[model samples]
Target: MARKAAIIGGGVIGGGWAARFLLNGWDVAVFDPDPEAPRKVGEVIANARQALPALSDVPMPAEGKLSFVSTITEAVEGSEYIQESVSERLDLKHRVFAQIQQVAPGVLIGSSTSGFKPSELQEKAPEPGMIFVAHPFNPVYLLPLAEVVPSPKNPPEAIERAKEILREIGMFPLHVRKEIDAHIADRFLEAVWREALWLVKDGIATTEEIDEAIRMGFGLRWGQMGLFETYRVAGGEAGMKHFMAQFGPCLTWPWTKLMDVPEFNDELVDLIAGQSDAQSGHHSIRELERIRDSNLIGFLRALKERNWGAGKVLREHDERKAAAFFGATDSAPKAAPLEMAHMQVLPGWIDYNGHMTESRYYFANSETIDAFLRLIGAGMDYVAAGHSYYSAETHIRHLGEAKLGDRLTGTIQIISADEKRFRSFVRIMKGEDCVATIEQLCLHVDMAAGKSSPASAEVWAKLKAVADAHANLPLPEGAGRAVGQRK
Candidate 1:
């Protein structure tokens, strides 16, 4: 059974959490006080739906349904996990926690409070085990890390379970050992933020300059490797000890005011705002976010292929996502056999006669069969390497008209095969009806010399293996016989 997740707040972070869970095939129920929550969340999901798939080469899981509820209790009624992304006020969190505890007794509850400790949050809740801290960075769908800080009273098993669930949603869950105010990553962020304020106060660097310094310099390296790891690599053969020893002296220097705080006066605020305006004179926030999302996708995808530390996490997350989608036993069976891809009649594919174009159906069926061939490892690369199967002849029988948005599928069956030629039976199905079938005879060809030739011994073995395995399956009955018939 697919587990359900409930998201409270429905703001940016909450919406992001919803996207992550939905993309991973977990049905999500969301609650927010705002009447506009659904519209706002729909917008976030619209962008995420397009962006998240581009991050991975693997096909994205079937999208899970997103439901909006008016009351928190309704949302958390049967939820396995409740993620609270309400306002970051202690009292607000306390109130929300109290409410959620009333509905979900044993479910794992996570507060997306960047600064509050679990101990403080548990003060208002009935049971500490039900609540913990799950601080995620902005754009939670793209950024992989989630800092999970469990309260001392929370069960160890709950934290581990949360880790597993987060992994399934394509997040790297870092379990913070001790619960401190602001947790782990936020502390570092606070320090940098203070320095940025000081720099702006002293007119040393504008907001954009600081951002540029990080993005153009160390931020690029930080995604695949952390600060310390990058520095350790730079230390050469001596590793961490040598690198720390070399930089240890700099800590004592007066170059950085490690302990200083910045005053947030009106003058400073205006100055920062003025500088931000100057920097972003060209593009809107939405435009900048799009650029950021594209860059993140490319960088993370490259890192994923390397199978490094972070990349390994991504690979595991992808596997979990795949399992969640295809492994859901309660899902409706595939409308057609799991044999080939199909495109229903859409507005673009139809002609003035309200029937699929003759050339278009052929194009569609050919592509469908190509997808099946690719699934069996007979795709582009296989064809490019001096050997490929080609359709010597195709006899198509169109039985019915397919209208726009009609659900369609194609199934392929191997009828016979040998070293030089192979035959296939294909059926194009609309709903439960088989609309068309094609009898195709394919010849193995040598692309290099552009001539008919025998398939490689290995290729012949694989084809025969697939043919034998699927031999018992009934071929489409109306499939016409080939012109040149063999006894």
Candidate 2:
């Protein structure tokens, strides 16, 4: 059954939380008095629908239902979890909690409060243990961190449940050691934000210049190797201990107004706002969001390649989902093309011709074949053991074009196979239409000896079964065509 989550507000943060839940296959009920809430939340979900799938190696779960409810009771009733993101007013949050408890008293309630601690939020609350903090970053659907803060009143079982739920939606739940104002990540961000303000206020830098410094320098390092680790690398021959000792004196330096505050006034606001407007005013908010999402996708994918930092979370999520989606059973393949891969044409997949680049079409087929190989017990472990399949020849035929945001499927039909080699036909489809086809021949090899070799009995048993199943099917049209063959 699809789980249900209640979102008490539908502003940006709330909308983001709604998208995260909905995309992760949780039905969501959002309660926000703003008349424009649906349209606003819809836009965030649209961005999510475009961006999140590109990060997944396996097919994403079917999106769950979303509804804008009239009241907190309607939103919370029957919900397995509730994420309160109402305005940052304690009284307002307390009232929302009161109403929520009247219906579903024990459901897990996570607050998307960036500043407030769990203790303050739990005050005067019945079942305060369930009402802890789940602070997520902006673009919650993409960035995975959710700082989970639990009060002493919150039991260990409930806190563990909260962390597990966050993981199911592909979030990294950093359990706060103790409930404190602003949790962990935001505390660092607040410091940076304050310093940025002081920089602009004192004419040290404009908003654009400060942003440039971060995105162009340490921000890149921090993307994968966060603060201490990045500094550890800067330690060069020595490690973090040596580096810390060397730079410890800089902590007392007056280089930053870390302890001081710039007067929160119109002048500072205007200076920052006016400079920000000049910096990125050309793009609309939606444009900026799309830009940010695309850039993040690239960076995160790089991290995923290294299986480091946030990428490890993404990879682990993919492995779990793939195993569940493609059940390890069914070793005997059916007499048809096995649908092995699901992918979307992300913004990064486009070319100047405004269609999915030719390379991605080929990539789709490779992904499909790779999945099929995994099915036959000849995956990474086989490769690690110095025995693997190597593509010997490939022929790609493009029938139609795929553009950005198009959902694509890749399926493989095993044409023939023996102990050492196999011939396969793969289709790259957009909806019901075959946008392209790939014909490839592969040979099993003993990598250590650098020679083609017969597949092991166990692997061959699985591979031959699938190949024999497809043997009776007619030859795919144009399967053996030459490079310049006619239609």
Candidate 3:
């Protein structure tokens, strides 16, 4: 059954919520007085459609219907979830919450208020237990974290339900143990923002320089391994305790003005704006967002492949989505020489000759193997259950040159399979011509025992089926061919 979600305000955050829910297969109805709400939300959804799928190979759920309604009641009526993103005013929230509760008495209400606490939001509501702060980061469709903070009056079941629904839409719901003015992530951001203001005010760093200081350094670290874990690694063999003891006194030093705020005078505003313009005037905001999304997709995908931090979350979500996709199908589709990979040659793939580099061919083959693994049910759950296919060896033969923007595809032929081992051939092509060929041998490993093992009966059956389907196909000449010519 298709689920429904309601958004009370259709600004950036609300539109983001709409895009997230809509893309994840939830019908979203948004209520915003702004006449331009539909256009604005549509723009955000367009960007989301371009970015979110680049993060994983698992096909996203079919997009759901999006409607812009006139009244909050029309938006929230019969909806499974309701998110309020109105102005950050306590009085306004009280009015909104009262209205939402009256219309959909028991439905969960998530307030996207960065400044207000759940207690403040629910103080005047008829059913306070259902109202909580489900604050999400900007570009909500792309970023996964949603801070779920409940008041003392909130029912535990409501909190869990909020978490469950957030996870359903590919969000990492962090439970805030206690409600505070600003949640955990915002608290950290506020500190840095305060310090940046001080830096700009004191002429110590331009806005662009301050941004570079972050994006080129700690920002990258924080993205993969957050502050504590990154510092733990920096602590070396002695670990966190020793490192903390060594640097504990620095906390008292006047190294930062986190408590102070620079006046929002025109001089400061002009200075910041001028620096920003000078730094990034070349690209429009939409173009910049696309660039940012692309960069994030690349980094997130790499991290996911390694199963680290946010990457682990992404991998887990993709696995669940894949499982759900297969389950919803009427019957499992037959696999025969599956076209497992399709991608344009990224700019980074070019070499000095302005052609695709040598290593990318192998990388494409590796991706093909990953796709094949997913097709045969060797997804995250299979690995989680302590079984996986690990590449033992690979041989590659290049036939033609590929350049930037070339549309590349890799077709995987199941050469042979057994209970313990499998061999496959991947033909890399640009359009119809074969550009490269890869012969790979993989072994099913008992991850817990750290040795080769027979594949699970179910997995073996899928592989055997594919191999049987390809039985009549001739093996590529590159298969079993040695790299060196001997006398």
Provide the TM-score for each candidate, comma-separated.
Answer: 0.76, 0.89, 0.73
The local distance difference test score of each candidate is 0.79, 0.90, 0.86
Sort the predicted structures by TM-score, highest score first. 2, 1, 3
C-alpha lDDT (0 to 100) for residue 168 of candidate 1: 74
Residue 244, candidate 1: Cα error in Å is: 2.1
In angstroms, give how far residue 269 of model 2 lies from its true place.
2.4
lDDT of 3 by residue, 332-357 (tens): 32445677766556556678898889
Instruction: Name the 10 consecutive residues with the lowest summed lDDT in model 2.
Output: 323-332
Displacement of residue 220 (Cα, Å) in model 3 is 1.3
Give the per-residue lDDT of model 2 (tens digit) for 1-487: 9999999999899999999999888999999999999999999999998899878866677789999988888898889989989889989999888888888988999999989999999888988888999999889999999999988899899989989989999999999988788888888999999999898999989988998999999999999889999999998888988898999999998988988999999988888889999999999999999999989998999999999999999998888777776673244589888888777776667899889998888888888888889999999999998999999999999999998667788888888899999999999999999999999999999999999999999999999999888999899998999899786
Q: What TM-score would candidate 1 get against the native?
A: 0.76
Question: Model 3 TM-score?
Answer: 0.73
Clashes by residue pair, model 3: none
Higher-scoring candidate on TM-score, 2 or 3 = 2
